[model samples]
Target: METDIVGVSEHRFDGGLLAATRRFEAAADVTREVGAGSVGVAHTLIALARMPGGVAAGLFARQGIPPDVLAAGLPGGGAGQASDAGAPRLGRLPVTAGLRAAFDAAAATARVDERVLLIALLARLEAGAVDLLAGYGRVDLDAWLTEVKAGRRVGDVFGPDGAIDPAAFGPGASRVLAVTVTEAGALGHERYGIALLLHALATTPGGLLEQAYLFLRRDVRALREQTLTLAGSRPRAGRGPAPERAPVPDEPVRQVL
Candidate 1:
C-alpha cells in the first residue's frame, strides 16, 4: 500500500478523506505557484501551514513559522501567490515520489485526517526544506504532532453550564457529535440525551471513548443497541411525584354540560 500512491484514488471520499484531499490540492497549487515541477515536501508543508481551520496551521503558528514566513523562506518566494484565481490547478502537475509514499501510507492506515496527513508529511521531511524550517525555529515535530492528536480532551467539550457544545472538541469529538446530533434531530429531539452520547461513543471512530471500549473488550454493537433502547425510555426529569395542592372548599359541584 505504501508503494502505490494511485491506490488513494480508489478510496472513498468520505467527510474525513475529503478534507485530506483538499489539503493535497492546496499543496499542488503551491507547487505550481512556486514554479516547482512537482509537489515536494516543502510545498506540502506550506500548503498545510496555510490551510484555514487546520490543525497544521495552528501547530506551525505555535512554532513561530507562520504560513507567510514559511512560504517566503522556501524556494521561489511565492508567499501569498497560490491564492490567485488564475493559479494552475493541482491536476496540472505531478507529485513527488516521497509525497506519494506519504499519501499511500496515510491512506493505508484507513484513518485519514489533517493530523494523520501532517504526521505523514513531517515523517518524510527532506534536507532542503527541513533546513529552512529549522532555521526559522526549533520545530519540535513530535510535540506538535502530540498537540494535534490530543490537544482537546473529551472533558474539555463541556462548557461552564455543564453542557457539551459538541463543537468545542477536536475532530474526533466532532465526528462523534455529528452523528449524535443528526440522530437526535431526526428523532425530533431538541436536545441530545446521555443515551445518544453513548451511542455516538459506540459508533464514532478514533475517539477516546472508542479506545476505552477496546481496552475493556466490550461489545460496541451490543452497547449501541442498549443505548438505543434507553433512547425510547421516558426522561427522568418530570417523572417525580406530583406537586402538592391545597384542597378546594365545597362550592357548587355543578356540571353545566
Candidate 2:
C-alpha cells in the first residue's frame, strides 16, 4: 500500500490511500457557512444564552467567566474590550443579552438560514469584521452568498445596481472553492492520488467537476479493465494502439455561482 500526505491551512494531515478528515472539515466549514453555523455561532450562542437576562460569566462559576462581559448599549462602550475585533458586533454589545439581541436581529434578517449567515460570517471571518448587523453588506461573497441564499434577493444582496465585479469577490471565496474541491475530489484515494492536482482541476470549473466525475467513473472502469487484463483478456486484433494525444481546445463556461 502507498502512503501520502495532505496539507491544509499551514500543515499536513497524512494517511494511506484516501485522506478524509481535513477535507471533511473544510467542506463542513463551507457547509456550515452555506447552511450551518455562521462564523459568529459561538458568539451568537453566547448572546442567545443571555436572553433570559443573566450574565454569561455566572453560569458556570467553576469555569470562571470574565466579569467584564456585562452588556453594553453599544459595542465597546463597556466590558467588550476583551472580545476580539473580528468578533461579530461582539464588542458592541456590552451585556450578553443585548449581544444576543443583535444576533437575533441578524438571524431575523438572515431568515434563520444558518448557512447563509455562516458563509457571510466566513467572509467576515476572512475579512476580520462583523458589522453584519447594519444595512450595506460585508461587501464580499461570504456576505453576499449568505444573504442571497438565505432569502435576501440577489439584487438586494448585490445592492441596487447590478454588477459582477472581481473586486467584489473575496479571496476567501477562492479559498473556499479550492478547499471544497480538494476534499470532494482526490486527496489520497488508493485508486487515485488527489491532492493539489485535484484541487486545481476540479475547481478550474466548467465541466472540470464533470471531468473529475468522469475520472471517478473511469476508476470503476479501471478496476474492470485491470481485472480483465489480469484474466488474460486481450483487445481484438483489429483494434490498434490509441492515437497520439492531441491538445484540447479551450472554451469558457458560465461564471461560478
Candidate 3:
C-alpha cells in the first residue's frame, strides 16, 4: 500500500498500525502549536491516502495483492496507462504499506474522496495551519532534527541554524533535514521527525488535551476536503475524461486478480 492505512503487512500489520498512529500523532503534535486554529490530523491522514495513486495502492493491498502486483492501478487492469486500483495514477507518489490501508478504508468506509486530501495538505500548509512546533531554548525542533540528522544527542547538535544542517546527514537522509521540519515531513523523516513533533507538542503552552484537539481539527479538515475530490473521481478514456465508474451510492465494480 502506498498511502497510510490500517491494513498493511498482516505479518507486521500490528506493528505498522502502532507506528503509523505514533507518527500521525507526532506530526499532529507539531501542528498543535499554531494558533488554536481549526486543523486536524484526520486531514493529514486522509490527504496522505488520497494522494493520486495513494488511494489505489491502499485498496489494492487491502484486497490482497503481492508487492509486485501493486504497480497496476487495478489488480487485473494489466500494465501501462491501464491501471488497476493499485497502480500510481501519475508521477511517483511515495506509498508505504501502512499508507495504503488508510486510503483503502477512506475509499471504502469514511466518505473521504481522496483529492481533497491533497487539497487539504496544500491549503493547510499554505495557510500555515501551525507554524514551527517550537523554537529553540533547551530542546527545540531544529535541535531535535539536528540531533537526529547528526546521529548524535540533542546537546551535541546545538549549533547555528538549529537542527543539524543537511550536511550532517548522509545523502539519503539529508534532504529531509533540509526541509526545516514541516508537519507533513514529520512522519516521512522516520523516528526523528515524529519524536521532534511529539516533544514540541508535549511541551506546548496549552495542556495536552487542547494540544491534541488542535491536531484533531486539522485532521478532520483534511479528511473533509478530500471528499470534495474523491467523490469526483472518474475513469478517463483518452482525449476527454470519462464519467466515474462508481458514484457515491454505487458499489465499485472491479475485477479480481
Candidate 4:
C-alpha cells in the first residue's frame, strides 16, 4: 500500500516504527543519565504504557512488568560522573532491517485497521501480554479502545520548528513514538504504525507485546488444546512422568504505546 510517510518519498512501514525504535536506542546510547542506555522496544513500550491512562502501561503493570525493570534497560543517570562534566556527547543509533521486518508483520496482521498501536497491542494478546489484559475481564477490543481514547487526539512530540530534534523527544520518547506513530499510521492508512507493532513483538520475544499479539490473532480454545498437547509430550522434570505441564494459552491477535 502507498503511504504518506513524512520526510520520505514512498510509503514504508519502517519510517514509523523503525525511526522511533532507532531514536530510543540512540537516546539510550548517549546521555549518561541514570535509567536511560541499551534501551529496547519493550523498555520504550513500558515507558509509554506508563503514560497516564496509557493502555501499554496498564497492561504491563497487570502483567508484572515493573518500572524498575524497564528502568534497568535505560541508561544510567551519570552515576559517579559528577566530577567529569566534560564527557563527550553520544551519537544516534541507526535502525536495523530486523526491526523493520517485525513492524511489517504487525502492520499486516492488524491489516492497517487500527490507529492506536497501544490499543492494538492490548487487543492482540500474546502470552506475556495476555497476563496483563487477563485482569480486564472479557475485553471488548473496540469498546476498550474507545474508552482509552476518549476525548484525546494524537499529539505531535516535535518542537516548534519542523525539525527532528532528539532533545525534544526526551528520555523514552523513542519507545513512545515507536507505538504512537504506528497507531497514527493505522488510522491514517499509513503503514508505519502497523510496522511498529509488528516490530515490537519480535524484539520483545516472549514479552508483553508478543503475548498481546498472539492473544488477539489466534483462537483461544484451540490454542489451549495445542499448548496442552505440546506440554504432555515433554519429559517430566524429575518424576516417572512429569505431571502434564499446564498449557499456557498461545492465542495470536493483535498493540499501542
Per residue, candidate 2 scores C-alpha lDDT tens digits across 180-224 of 333323222111122332333333433235345666675333443
**Highest lDDT against the true fold, candidate:** 1
The TM-score that candidate 3 achieves is 0.17
lDDT of 4 by residue, 90-175 (tens): 23322222222223444554332112444444343233323333333333445645754462332332334322223223223344
Better of 2 and 3 by TM-score: 2
Candidate 1: residue 249 lDDT (0-100): 11
Candidate 1, residues 1-257, lDDT tens digits: the string is 42222346534223443453463577777766766766666677677667544566666765777766665666543222222333333555666666666667777666665566677788776565666767656886666657665655654445554444433333454566667765565454555566776787777764556667788998677877788667653444533332232111111201100
Give the Cα error of residue 11 in candidate 1, in Å.
2.5
Q: On a 0 to 100 scale, what is the lDDT of residue 47 in model 1?
A: 78
The C-alpha lDDT values of all candidates are 0.57, 0.29, 0.29, 0.35
Per-candidate total of colliding backbone pairs: 0, 18, 34, 45
**lDDT measured at residue 87 in model 3 versus the true structure, 0 to 100:** 36
* Deviation in Å, model 3, residue 4 alpha carbon: 14
Off by over 4 Å in 4: 1-39, 73-91, 96-98, 109-257
TM-score of candidate 2 to 2 decimals: 0.22
- On residues 1-257, what C-alpha lDDT tens digit does candidate 3 reach at each position? 34433232222222222233343443233223322122233224332332222332233233343323221222221111212345322122223222333344434433333332222232222111112112111213243324332343433333342334323222222222332243223223211333333333333234333346576774333432343233332233322322222111111111100
Against the true structure, candidate 1 reaches a TM-score of: 0.53
